[model samples]
Target: MSRPDILLYTANTMNGWKPLIFLHEAEIDYELVPVDLGRKEQKAPAYLKLNPNGRIPTIVDRGNGDFAVFESGAILWYLAEKYDRFLSHDPKERSETLQWLMLQMGGIGPMMGQAMFFQRIAKPNGDEVPYAINRYVAESRRLLEVLDTRLAGRDWLVGDAMSIADIATYPWARSYFWATVSVDGLPHLQRWFDRLDAMPRVQAALQLPEPRPSVFGEGDITAAAQENAARFKDQ
Candidate 1:
């Protein structure tokens, strides 16, 4: 195979999967360089030069003057614009697509991440703070309801076809179970999710760099979470 022009530095987390889905859907040639979050590889000086925030899902576009882009949402926007795929050029549709994409970046991603941090990570470490857990989980559920409302009677979040908005949000929304957020009464969101879940590209993207571990699976996730938490605490 030809050398990939895009180098994706990522983990198996929800945010990390956004670019993977987009790249797969767009059929772009990219290399996956898995960042070992547990090992604090993201915090190392070399990686920090690429992503000052020391986060996963940073992409170095070697084909584009060796440009590096951080933040998952930004990466999606950059790739979509560069490849001229999964994004609309029409004024209204493009704005709508970006609005929903921002919702994922500002709403679903943060709320769900906090929910997961508190529900799965904090609670297991004997730091079971009920207020934080309930606060984030409820907000995450409410965000899902917002998406459900947007998806009502519509197949995609924006325009008639799936765009970066859908790709960015799906990874987080699908992890509601891990975050302890429910989709109990959200039919539209559920339907949209099932549709994306059934897509060949989405399924293919989730497996790159290996499958992510389930919260319900066998492993010492608590210790893992604690290690990660300690890293962030020092940061």
Candidate 2:
């Protein structure tokens, strides 16, 4: 199937931003194909063919045999290996990068995602599940502390340079407050966040496919979310 040079199917969500950061940082040419989560577009048959899991942030690399890659972490890994960027060359450094990437992929990403769902999205829907909220928030905060400690004397997650681990982890960390987790006491994490926030590449990645509004905001998205929530509740 012919497609754009690099077609990214994604929503304006955290998981969606992960590979985007890498795409911009690596200077890979791509076209953004926004997926409307509010309308359940991801579950459509055509999209499901690209990603059996029916998730956003899937990439179809037309330059590489119309190859479709799904799952944010796997997408990042594929891009890094294909473009020969982010993932380190040294064995020890490469291992460190992959380990920290997995920390975001397996640990913080899932925990904080649930935290956001319960604390921010689900609550206003009259589905305030406190146990779920508290459990995820506490765990998400704990993960932030872990990142804080890991970044105490370092600038990046793995080696000296910013790798896929940092890219994979940044979107979730940037949305820490959405999880009701405070980073005030985590000075190192704050410093790292600020440092990355200042990067030109990171900034550009956050605002891909011009004309879309900023996804990161502390403002009210409840009404819009509720509309989408109603659809999800029926399932």
Which model scores highest in TM-score?
1
- Quality of model 2 by C-alpha lDDT: 0.83
RMSD of each: 2.7, 2.6
Off by over 4 Å in 2: 1-4, 209-235
RMSD of 1: 2.7
Question: Candidate 1 on 35-114: residue-level lDDT in tens?
Answer: 98867999999999999999998999988888999999999999999999989999999999999999999999999999
TM-score of each: 0.91, 0.90
Taken over the whole model, the C-alpha lDDT of each candidate is: 0.87, 0.83
Q: Please count the clashing residue pairs in each candidate, in the order shown.
A: 0, 0
- In candidate 1, position 145 carries an lDDT of 96
